[model samples]
Target: MGRGRQKAKATKQARDIKYYSPNTDYSALQRELKGPEGRATSHFANDPVEPDYSAYVDKYADDLQEDDGEVDTRRIG
Candidate 1:
């Protein structure tokens, strides 16, 4: 088909889909929304526990403090 005909066909299909509303099955929707049975709600239920990094942060707190609060960005090779 020509470009104009193809574009017209696409526009008609888009309009039809935009105004179309099929019959909804509420029970099926509810079941689908509620998700599968006997499954844990948390997806991260099997994730490994993370170790606390507060100790490292506390150790480097004084070393990380700025003296003049200004960054020197001049290139140093």
Candidate 2:
């Protein structure tokens, strides 16, 4: 109900949290970290399939090129 009581409770909680050490399961962790036993071939095992971008190539192609079909790579302030 008072500041002193609240401070004491908060300090006790902080000490308890600071000293707490949770037990870890190393064998289960090793299996999970090791990944699948067999791999067909993939850089990313869980990568989502990508959609085809060929349909938009014609629409946005002009944005990437200048009037003479060259990218204006010169820096401008």
Candidate 3:
């Protein structure tokens, strides 16, 4: 190959790429859920068909309790 073409082939072979998994913190989510602005944000973020948990107490009464604020790792992938 010519000089310019040879360099292009060598550069392509020398290149390396790697991908990493993203890290997500669930604790921050709990803080957001308890925060004032979070309540309003949650309302706008949720589906209209779904009941709002922040305003309605009985909506998620079966799924949550006052003392049950712990994160469930079992549900995570």
**Which parts of model 1 are misplaced by more than 4 Å?**
1-18, 44-51, 58-77
Q: How does model 3 fare in lDDT?
A: 0.66
Query: Estimated TM-score per prediction?
Result: 0.39, 0.51, 0.20
| Prediction 1 global C-alpha lDDT | 0.88
* Model 3, C-alpha of 19: deviation from truth (Å): 5.8
Candidate 2 residue pairs in backbone clash: none
Per-residue alpha-carbon lDDT of model 3 for 1-77, expressed as tens digits? 47998888777766632344457788998877578652444446454586556866778687666557776569655
Candidate lDDT values, in order: 0.88, 0.87, 0.66
Off by over 4 Å in 2: 40-75
Ranking by lDDT: 1, 2, 3
Residue range with the least summed lDDT across 10 consecutive positions in model 3: 38-47
Model 2 Cα lDDT, one tens digit per residue, 34-76: 8788965768758788899999989989866746766679999
